[model samples]
Target: MLGSQTQTPPKEASSSITDKTKIKARYFMIWRWHFYAGLYVIPFILMLSITGLVMLFDDEIEMITYQDELVVMPEAMTLPVSIQLDKVQTMYPHGTVTQFIPSKAIDRANKFDVRLADGRSVLVTINQYTGDILGEIDRSDSWYQLANDIHGTLLLGQWGDYLIEIAASLSILLIGTGLYLWWPRDHASIAGFLKLRFSNTRLFMRDLHANFAALFSIVLLLFLLSGLAWTSVWGGKLVQAWNTFPVYYTWGDKPESHLTHADLNHGSEKELPWNLEQSVLPESNQHIHGAYTSSETDKGYVATQNNINIDSIVKQARGLGFTQYKLFLPQSEKGVYTLAANSMGGDITDPRLDKTTHIDQYTGDVLVDVTWDDYTVLAKLMAAGISLHQGDVSVFNKALNAVFCLVFVLISLSGMLMWWIRRPSGKTRIGIPPHFESEGLWKAGIAGLFVVAVCFPLASVALVLFGLADWLMFKPRR
Candidate 1:
């Protein structure tokens, strides 16, 4: 009975060995497809990686090149918001003002945006006292912008963007298959996982490729995934899911009767307007009259009801601890002068109130005042994300971004090197692994399913065509 059991055990072991062999063969076939795809798409991936690295430190480069224009005044009085607007208008009479970004930090001093008569937008930094245009920045002429153009679309626009998306998708597949290939079947040696002797050229190359990929795998994945999210359909869906909160801006109806600057200062307590009704005050009346206003005692003061001059308004804003303030002049009969103040106390990264004051052009009465602290939670998050992304959060953030750029360049170079070394040669060598092959129709079918699952429409179509070719070349044997 013991001899018979031993004989049965041998037969069972033989069957199990055969099953394991078939499974490995199947995996090998899938790996061949991945290898070929990586070889074909590597050049495109290399270009994207290189260009993306340059774009990471775009702000630093801009600062270095435009030092004269970017420098700020040592001690300029906070000019009236309207006076600043008038100065900008006087300097560029043909250009129309689009947006006035109140100074938030040293980098933002006297800077504002204007759209020229020729449809080109220009970012200008001006002298607050003389209103002289100190420096004009054209994004079209910027090297960083040029690099962004290449990184985003290879300078081919939407078509380039799509190509990048395809490359990213292929990279995911390549990494997955590469990881599987790296896994040893039963080798217990540490040398197999990490260390490799440089005596054999092929082994050195293979090890170099595998080790680099393993080391920077997570960062490379994040870089590719974030980029794809910007350019691909599925990636867009992923980003949308990540940012699910809605961004909404509410504006009140235009006031029925315009209030003059005089109407605001002497308004009767009996006729004090509703909060919503008073919300449309022109830009000039928004600053806190005193150094500070408490929530309980200053409800009336919060209403736009002042007729201060633009120069006085700027002084008041500065006095109230606002380092950066921008004033806008009303364009038409019903337009309100606007004053925007940023008062986070010189810490760009710190969250603070963004105050907007609307003052009646005719009357000096304040119409509407809104604060940054009053924004919805989602809106605040979005603002902070944008600031961080733009390298505008703080000096420390800008330095960190520069380091991130250097890291990105290293990652791209390492990835390209890995791809080049692992490229297959037609000749089969002893140390170099030969291409994997499919044994039966079922194995081929599984490979097709995997290709379709990863590549979506392109792989699905390619698989169908491959199947058709197979049928024509070798029909099933009965």
Candidate 2:
């Protein structure tokens, strides 16, 4: 038997071996994709986690860091909002009052956003009790604001936003592939799924990495989706447009306007709710000879009405149950007074209390008022997600987010440590996962990739480049 030519294996055995080989190849292919995604995402995760942690505690940090301005002793009596605005104006007479933020607590100062005649903006803080000019802070130069800017766009504006959006999109693939790799197979017990191994250093890091990733996968995905909703392409052009409120219906007769809520936004701070950022700010009807006259415009005709001052608008806002809100003054003759109190501005801890109202500058009529109940299902989810993402909902939420960010950091480092240990010794080239030619695996992957491409344009571009690299540089040696 030893000397005889080896008998041909059974057809079933041959097919079984081929099937197993295909499965192994598919697993390795997924691992390769995971490794590549992690490599690209590691730097971004580190940056975001650090910056996110800072932003999560922005209020606390500001209270401590800018104590002279942000913190004050409680007094029995406080100055009127109008009087405080007047005092601030007296100090910065050349500055135009853009926004008035009333103090939420007795110990806090009322803040006035002033745009100077020289085209510079500053946050003028006034002692609510004594009407003393506590300090003036250049909002742009705020440390927390810089952290926020870096978190949102790396301070590179649109280009940075695109880079971050792409990273976030690819991170989805990374999470998916990580979960697959973490899935247990042929396990003797639940230890692989639940217990982290510590006998070996490599095994410990591997298990830790896998476990943290698994634990925060859903949270990370929600955070990415919520963050992406504020992006230019997918969130702005696609999801946001689809979920926006029908202001025409809400306003009854839509007023003509050339500007949108986006104009109110400054740097990394979103002054309006995510759903209404692109909404057209309704303009007031112009006054004409004290007669109700019809006017012709692109939208339609509107009757002329009596105009009112900011004092009246402020009174109306207070009467309408706006306690701690931001009142944005009209930017132009026709611009409406925009009053907002929402999680976006960190004014309220509860997303359900989000309220935005557009008051007609000329008529003093409420043009459109949107509350949390008015948001679409998707929009509501986005609002809540953003609140949680920012840790503005509650103290518990803040602690949870802090833990999540720390866990993300640990996961990232553990992954790198595992890779360093497992990588080939003293090799100039990165030890790429072994390539196994499998048409079926590639076909499935391409199909899924097509879906991702459709959803994320920038990520699709990155994927294309990665695909080209895989086909050209990482092709199996002959």
Candidate 3:
């Protein structure tokens, strides 16, 4: 295809990708930033991937290990829920039942959470058909729970929370820059664009790093955003507070709760949606009125006389088409019964199925019923993204999540291997990409980052730390 007459060359060659030495300007800038982020993000991403893989199969693992508690012989007719409560009371006589998980399947057992007099909590399993006590377990000690705690707080509380936030912030840089590096070069062949093409280990590592990231970019980005939505600062203070479902009632009065969802959360993992976390727990007010109805209380409650039966509640939920739901018992006299289902808890992973309702303890009136349709725009995104990130949507989703986890680990390790292979021999220096001495662009990029810092203070703080580290250790000699 060579022409007899000389012609003006394309601004950049198509094969520039094969030679990193030929990369310049914005591409090189992106590569350098991506390199810097990988140094910090790899360890955390690795930890998350490993823990996430286990968490994806939390139900399966717990089922095998807790078959006695979770599985029971199917029966023609299960015993009434009250009879099962009596059995649970026998195991922990002094325990106050705070929550009840009714069996979702025919051969499964119901779980009751008891808060003991000594301030300890245990989950007592009850066989619905025979009303036999299966076994009790400390709520926080399970293998999957341990993985969840590590995934959330790294078992270090606030300090670990901050470290995770920084990792997530840097991953934004990593993913964004990785997309830039993975962009199809001018005149790139379809094979070169999509398939791995490498004669050397160096090319193999780079290709794996870029192509895999490119393939899973959308999933990785969603995981980062949804996971970050649980972080203390960015998620809790800034976004979650504003987007919470606004509690509305026909009655003119605003309400307050004796407790929030945080009080009932399972260890470090969030048990409720971002919207419900901020809402006040509703109380049964004597002045409020609804259609004539009865109410109920546990056996030990002060107003136990003519207590509303739990079967009635379950029947009502079933009537509403709730395939699965969690029930939280009222602690005190004024407390309301809370029944909730959302993507956050893996019951009907679609956000449109998100539903939470509080029934007045005394009146049996619906105090609040917040549905998925009530969530804010961003809250809706978080709900769907969280379900996808957690691999709870469907069978296909879980398989996809596992695959993504494998690709995620491959991307991180391959990039690390590439750096190892490219580093100069006998040099203590990490091979940071060379700084571009371009006109205006470098300064412009810094100004843009300053704007980003202004918007995301945590990311800005991370940038400063990375900049200081570079000045001390990675900066080239004069």
Query: Better model by TM-score, 2 or 3?
Result: 2
TM-score computed on alpha carbons, candidate 3: 0.87
Model 3 agreement with the true structure over 380-429: per-residue lDDT tens digits: 99898888888888999999999888888998899889999998654347
Ranking by TM-score: 2, 3, 1
Error of 2 at 379 (Å): 0.5
lDDT of 1 by residue, 58-124 (tens): 6567778877777666555656556776677677777766445565454445766666776666767
Report the Cα lDDT for candidate 1: 0.52
Which portions of model 1 miss their true places by more than 4 Å?
Answer: 1-10, 104-108, 186-192, 235-478
Per-prediction RMSD in angstroms? 11.7, 4.5, 5.9
Q: Which 10 consecutive positions of candidate 2 have the poorest summed lDDT?
A: 296-305
Per-model CA lDDT versus the true structure: 0.52, 0.81, 0.76
Q: Tens digit of lDDT per residue, candidate 2, span 354-416?
A: 999988767787888899989988888988888899998889999999999998889899999
Q: Count clashing residue pairs per candidate.
A: 22, 0, 1
